[model samples]
Structure formats: C-alpha cells, structure tokens
Target: MEMQNITLSLPKPILHRVKILAVQRQSSVSRLLTQAVEKMLEEETEYEMARRRQMALLAKGFNLGFRKPASRDEIHER
Candidate 1:
C-alpha cells in the first residue's frame, strides 16, 4: 500500500506516555496509532452493516400468522 506522511501535534504529556507505550509494545508510535485507527474504522464499518441489516428486517416486517384481526372483546375475554 502507498503511504503519505502527515504531521501531527500532541500535548507533551500525552506524547511522552505514548512513547513509553510504544517502547513497551516494541513498536513505533506511528505504527501503534495506525493500528488503533484501523481498528476503530473496522468496528465502525461492522456496526453500520449490522444497523442496515436490522433496518432492512424492520422495513420488511414480519408475519404473525393471523388471517384476520381479533376483536377487543375477544382479547379481553374473562
């Protein structure tokens, strides 16, 4: 894949912590951030797909197996 470099700015404290985390993980900060962003996008895509499927199911509706509507009296029968 082709990659383009971009500049980013972060607070000193956060950058310091991220550097420590990168060392602990044996990875560079750039790689760590890339993985995190990729994971976030993947989750967002999955959630959107699930939401569309559920919405389609709702739009299609369901069959309750009733030939005719029941009267309120029948429903409230003693």
Candidate 2:
C-alpha cells in the first residue's frame, strides 16, 4: 500500500508516554498511532451498523400471531 506523511503536534508528556509504549511493544510510535486510529474507525463503523440493524428490526416489528392476554381483573374475580 502507498503511504503518505503527515504532521501532528502532541504535548511533550503524551509524546513521551507514546515513545515509552512503543519501546515496550517493540513498535514505532507511527505504527501505534495508525493502529489506534484504525481501531477507533472500526468501532465506530460497527456501532453504526448495529444501530441501523436495530432500527430496521424496529421498523419491521414483531408478531407471534397470538391475541394479547386480558387484564388481571378480567381474568380473575376481585
């Protein structure tokens, strides 16, 4: 895949932490950032897909082909 370069500005403390994480994980900060962004996008996409599916199910509604039961007072004498 083709790759491009971009610039980002992060606080020194955050950058230091990212650098430490990179060392611990044996990965570069660039790769870590890429993975983070990819994961965020994937989660958002999955959430949207689930939301749309739920909405579709709601639109279709549910039916058991049975009449609803009567109220408690109707079924039992007080």
Candidate 3:
C-alpha cells in the first residue's frame, strides 16, 4: 500500500495521555490512530450493508396467505 504523510494537531493534555497509552501498549501513536480509523471505517461499511439489505426486504414486502379481505361486519361480530 502507498503511504501518505499528513500533519495533525491535538491538545497537549490529550497528546500526552495518548503517548503514555501508546507506550503501555508497546506501540506508536501513529499505529494506534491508524487502527482506530480502520475500525471505524469497517463498522460504517457493515452498517451500510445491513441497512441496504433491510431496505430491500421492506421493498419486496411479504405474503400472509390471505385470499380476500374480511368484511367489517364479520370482523366486528362477537
């Protein structure tokens, strides 16, 4: 894969915490951020696929096997 470098700015306190966390995990901050972004994109793609499937099912509708509509009087009869 081709790699492109970009600049990012973060608050000092947050950066400091991230640095510590990276060290504890034995990883670099860049690697941690990359993993987080990858996870977010994966989840978004999965959500979109599920949404499309549900929409298709709704559009296709379902069959309840009823041949004809019942009269209102029949429905209301005790």
Candidate 4:
C-alpha cells in the first residue's frame, strides 16, 4: 500500500502526553496515532452496518401471533 505523510498541530500539553504514551508503549507517535485512527474508523463502520440491519428489521416488522384487544377497558384491566 502507498503511504502518505501529513502534519498535525496539537496543543503543547497534548503533544507531551502523546510522547509519554509513545515512550511507555515503546512505539512511535505516528504508529500510535495510526492505530487509533484505524480503530475509530472500524468502529464507525460497524455502527453503520448494525444500524442498517436494525432498520431493515424494523421495516419488516414482526408477528407475535397477537390480536388487538376487543375493548380499551380490557387493556387497562388489572
């Protein structure tokens, strides 16, 4: 796969924390950021797919072998 380079401007405190995390994990900041981005994209894709499936099911509707009550009092009856 082809790779591209991009520059980001972050606050000083945030950059410091990212650098510390990189050192603790023994990985480059670039690699850590890439993994984070990949995970976020994957989660978003999964959410969209699940939402579509749910919408389809809703459109199809369900049959529980149920019928409407004969009277409103029957529904409210305890």
Highest TM-score: give the candidate number: 4
Q: After superposition, how far is residue 60 of candidate 2 from its true place, in Å?
A: 1.4
> How are the candidates ranked when ordered by lDDT, highest leading?
2, 1, 4, 3
Q: What is the alpha-carbon lDDT of model 4 when measured against the actual structure?
A: 0.95
lDDT of 1 by residue, 49-77 (tens): 99999999999999978687778998899
Worst 10 residues of 2 by lDDT: 62-71
Badly placed stretches (over 4 Å) of model 1 are 64-78
* Reference-based lDDT, each prediction: 0.95, 0.96, 0.94, 0.95
Off by over 4 Å in 2: 64-78
Candidate 4 wrongly placed segments (more than 4 Å): 68-78
Model 3 earns a TM-score of: 0.77
Q: Cα deviation of 59 in candidate 2 (Å)? A: 1.3
Any residue pairs clashing in model 2, and if so which? none
Q: Which residue pairs clash within candidate 3?
A: none
TM values, all candidates: 0.78, 0.76, 0.77, 0.80
